[model samples]
Target: MSSARTVHLLRHGATVRPGLLLGHVAVAVTPQGIADCIRVAAGATFTQVVSSDLSRAAECAAALGAPVRHDARWRELDFGAWDGRDPTTLPSDALAAFWRDPDQAPPPDGERWSALIARVTAALADLPDATLVVTHGGALRAALASACGFDARQVWAFDLPCAAMVTLRIWPDSAQIVGLRT
Candidate 1:
């Protein structure tokens, strides 16, 4: 039997524009954000650290003092034309529809929710045991959905604030929620 693996999914620190859809916009994490990651890392020992190539996640991963493996597959949902745009700027009806059913109404030219889940799960599949992943909120939510059997709507309802960390105990055939640290 494969030994159980512990995967810690950490949301990157707060971004420059907290209210905007930052998909691939390359924003930096706040100073406090870096400190937040350090505080979390101080208590946990990880075998490997991975991060999305985005600066926010990468910077936070660097703060953990581990050699990071950067992968674009762990990136936030590609918002396409809506990337970096404030949600309030979009038409209310369109925005509401997208939120109500992201899988069905992705932003103009953006990645669908199903695509996001697939890529995030694929990245998770490649991680080593006892790994830490620093990524976007959307990506972390995808991990929760994939490992915890949360549907799209349920995943969206979760509140994964910036710098939050969730640990998952994974096996070849199953996964368990270890803990959540906000």
Candidate 2:
């Protein structure tokens, strides 16, 4: 067995609702968005492709030219009542607090920061070497936390634009970013 494993977590491209919290809200990805993702992964080979069951992520996984394993565990954090709502429209203080400490100020009735970390940690336990996970930005950040032990706020500092890809080399107790493509 290899001493380390590599996982590439690719965030799905821009969706229909560009600025809304998109958890469990199925949104269509523009054709150019898909092309952007494909271009990012162009010529990058992986042993396996897994994707969030959401169509936005699944479609990009399919475009990567591999049979995909759809796993809901990779789904984005449920925004609860805030799902599909623009942050600009919400109470600014509440939105700011959620960004500062999501666990403390989670979206009303939404999934907690702990919940997201838990599910993503479990998913990391079941992966093959050189795997590609086509997922959402929230899920991508969760993967960084799950594999590297970065806290919620620290993970948020990562700039995971749509179609951004983070490649990590994961060991038993730690992970290193091997590459990144935005």
lDDT, candidate 2, equals 0.88
| Residue pairs of candidate 1 with colliding backbone atoms | none
lDDT of every predicted structure (CA atoms): 0.88, 0.88
lDDT of 1 by residue, 1-182 (tens): 98988999898988767899989898988999888877876666688999999999999999888799999999999998999999889989988988888899999999999999999989999998889999998999888888888988898776788998888998887888888887
Cα-based TM-score, every candidate: 0.96, 0.96
Local error of candidate 1 at residue 91 (angstroms):
0.9
Span of 10 residues, lowest total lDDT, candidate 1: 37-46
